[model samples]
Target: MKKPLIFVYFFLLISPVFAQMEFGFDDKDAFSPHSIRQVRRADVMYNNTVWVRMDLREKQNEPFFAANSEITKIIIDAVKAGVLRPYKNDSLITRMSIQEFNDNIKIPGADEGLTDEDLAMGFGDSDFGGGDDWGGGDWGSEGGAEEDAGPDEFFPNNIYILELKEHRMFDRKRSRMYYDIQSIKLIIPGELYPTGINKELATFSYKELVSNVFVDNPAAVWYNAKNTAENKNLADAFELRQFTGKIVKYSNPKDNVIDDIYKGNLKLGLAKSQEYEHRLLEYESDLWSN
Candidate 1:
């Protein structure tokens, strides 16, 4: 009886180690209480991490892009309000300062060639360049000051794309699969840049967004077109998968996105993305088969 009691105590002490080994997760990777369907790592039979790109301009995703209450607007406002912290990337490990976030969203070269004193002296005025016949060379034209008069800032509406990093895992204990979202990233479309380079504004932890930012914030809403009264919280909308997104990347040893794998061939990349989707469905179906 004494030997059996000692063995039981020893097993209890080592159980956590076994759990870590089974899932390759440390305590830091434990599921958050706010997670939709909190499944223990040990219960995850299979896991696939995928990156999805959501185009808010899409008809199916318009609810999230509603005029004033755009999801991007809400997030940006929250960050500005100091209520939400942004991350450097989807890893969610490094925190981004508010200044850094602001810098990233600004239209590149928009503020170039203009100083505070220049604006105060009315050097930016259109009339200053036209009426003045001092040198007759158009000072603004020589200095390219006219280009600086373009839009100096980017609005939330300009951010029409969002990227999500998530893990789709089959929880054998629950006999179901779960979409465990990790992070949400705001993307500045390539068209917005002169060089056609898409810029990542910042990444927000999905757990933090769901549990704190969107959960109780009245401003963060999913606009309901049919009935204004039926508008739901952004958190609920995400859980319901109301937005449609394209799968861009899945777990790969080389960590290449579909476009890269397909060598920038849009059609092939799209087809491969669909294939991955079908594979997920087939995997779930096969789980119940003999």
Candidate 2:
């Protein structure tokens, strides 16, 4: 009887351990879609999601926009080839079809009333000047009716802004903090549009990007200006954080961006963004305190 009671007590004491192990095994992939590391939910002591905006035209980010192998071009081509899945937003819940992706990236008035043959002819002076009526027949009229010349479609260079959504978390199991990127968004600058409102093309899962798009592609390169032989894969460049980005927002109760919180004061918002960066660094140090 004494032996049985001891065995029963020991089982109860170790039951929680077994339960924890099972939970970790089952839910290890919960964050896998967005994170390279398999972090268990129970091990996450703290978490904060942040949004960052990167300007590819910036000197520090020029490698991502290198000639002939721009990151934007690689991603856009992959989407068009049906090899990548685009999301409607950073939530990654809803998927945007290929048609939707195309429409989003297209310029407002591009390709309007233009046929394949018209496109093939090219928008050249010679092509529109051979007519005998009013130096190309009124220039803005077709078949005795006025016509509007639509705006041109977007080019890879026009997509200069990249938005990243990532979670900064402290994992108790690893006793370290991790920046787990979730999604990336492409943005056409507001200046490109008449209304001056920036347009979001589409969001993509970083998991798919790292696994499928950037991993083995030869064209996805991070150009090395100093050393021609030292060019790195885009995936490795991202892992090294070889780019500069400004924090636009962080996890907050109101879901407000830095600009919104500072009432659109650009200087104040920039300072606030810096403050948040410092706080994140200080947080890890604080955790080590006695």
Best by TM-score: 2
Residues forming the 10-long window of minimal summed lDDT in candidate 2:
138-147
lDDT of prediction 1: 0.77
Leading candidate by lDDT = 2
For all predicted structures, in order, the TM-scores are 0.76, 0.78
Candidate 1: give the clashing pairs. none
lDDT of 1 by residue, 175-235 (tens): 8778889899999999988889899999998888776567767767899999999999998
Q: Name the runs in model 1 displaced over 4 angstroms.
A: 1-37, 113-151, 288-290
- Candidates' C-alpha lDDT: 0.77, 0.78
Candidate 2 per-residue C-alpha lDDT over 1-290 given as tens digits, one digit per residue, 9 for 90 to 100: 69999999999999878756755554444645467665888788899999999999999999999986788877776664445778899999999865566567767766665677877766311111223221233211111212222235467778899999999888887687888888999998999889999999999999898886787677779999999699998889988889999999999999999999999999999999999988988997898672
State in Å the error of residue 168, model 1.
0.5
lDDT, candidate 1, residue 282?
Answer: 92
